[model samples]
Target: MISQFFVLSQRGDNIVFRDYRSEVAKKKDGQEEAPPVFNVDGVNYFHVKVVGLLFVATTRVNVSPSLVLELLQRIARVIKDYLGVLSEDSLRKNFVLVYELLDEVIDFGYVQTTSTEVLKSYVLNEPIVVDAARLQPLGPAAIFMQGTKRMPETAVTKSVVANEPGGRKREEIFVDIIEKISVTFSSSGYILTSEIDGTIQMKSYLSRNPEIRLALNEDLSIGRGGGSIYDYRSLSGSGVVILDDCNFHESVRLDSFDMDRALSLVPPDDEFPKRDNLKLK
Candidate 1:
């Protein structure tokens, strides 16, 4: 996130600072630009630069790289904890968003272990919930916040006989299959929360596991009734899913009445398989 700071004077002069950094130049004008100064509210000041502000802002931001990695790890950890077991395929499924969030933090100048290793470790060991409020509701109940639609399906039942003819119970197969599936789940509620610093927080349960690897033919919606709100289709712990056609209304706003083109954030069709990965062991 791009941050900005201001240097202001009480009378009327205000200085806004954002980033900070070191200088490498010959001593010109007999001095080094007074460390790139700025004025605050009326006082004449200097010694401020985008890079310098960045340093100060980073300290103030206080979001450590390790914390970011830990968060990513915890996301995977949550899935494992809830499922009571872990699988490499499952880890791979959820790593997409975890990696994206980690990249967001890395752009802020912090570093952590590779996202893959972090997820691996998380699966091996449960992650410590940093903010209970962030994880207020425990178990599957917490994640399933919205109502879901029972997509129509054709279930077929069959049984297979064992090779040994002595006397073995046949294996039965229950196939709840469908040619087209539309998993309709929606959430319109939020939980009020706050960080340690009293930051206003809002969270909601999602009725879908957003982490499953699937090819969504549409872009993720963000706001209310936007279809991509919590992004349940892309995260872990979201419940049952179905593949369906994706269409968008022509008339809609992007962000607060801002004119922006809707971009397809979904992965390419070739990148995702045409079928579900889950199968009975």
Candidate 2:
């Protein structure tokens, strides 16, 4: 069976996460200014959490839809292979959850692309295996399965030449894998705060319960090979903040932004007051 895949890009303003309930007032000139946000230098730091995945399936075959199922199965196999560390039963359950979640995302206006040539089909594979007793009988179980037939080969046209010789662009395999299990994944994120700034913020997949926290006060310095503070002066005010919790239990991997690599973000004078400047203005 032939499978057509497309990659998802983190592009456009259409896919935005705005949780505000109340609308901000617009200026009389009709220009709405962006709301207050922290500036990391010149750019705003936006935290990203995986809401869900979206699958846009377009049937290119003129007569058969067998490949769509094959494509979905391939996606499921990849996810199960790479991310299946749980028990057999739990793995299966989460695989199904991914299917259901992607379905829900597609239904909730996630796929806003306008491609009339291809018909859109939403498959929510969220099976109610858990709490099965809570499910009410909508009708006869066999009757509900009536419409899910494999598309016949007669319905599709056979091997028509593409108008463009290059054909369509190929999608990234990871994106489809993400979309395939989008419904089932729950993100485990953490709140990161700086002691010097008293700032609190959250980030997905960063670990709420870290395995370690290294407090780097003024004059205190650390690095992999005992690098000196003068060697790190090029880093500016950025410093590392470490937390020791089970979540981030991995060995120290420091860079320009992390704790082991540089000095604390506090200004040097503020931390160690100069003797000449000790005289109050």
lDDT of each: 0.28, 0.26
Query: Highest lDDT among the candidates is held by which one?
Result: 1
Runs of candidate 2 exceeding 4 Å displacement: 1-56, 59-95, 108-208, 211-259, 262-281
Clashes of 1: 43
RMSD of 2: 26.6
How do the residues 139-214 of candidate 1 rate in per-residue lDDT, one tens digit apiece? 5754564575432221111101111145443232222322332233336443332111111111111122122222
Q: Please report the candidate that would top TM-score against the real structure.
A: 2
> Worst lDDT window (10 residues) for model 2?
172-181
How large an RMSD does model 1 have?
20.8
- TM-scores, in order shown? 0.16, 0.17
Candidate 2 achieves a global lDDT of: 0.26
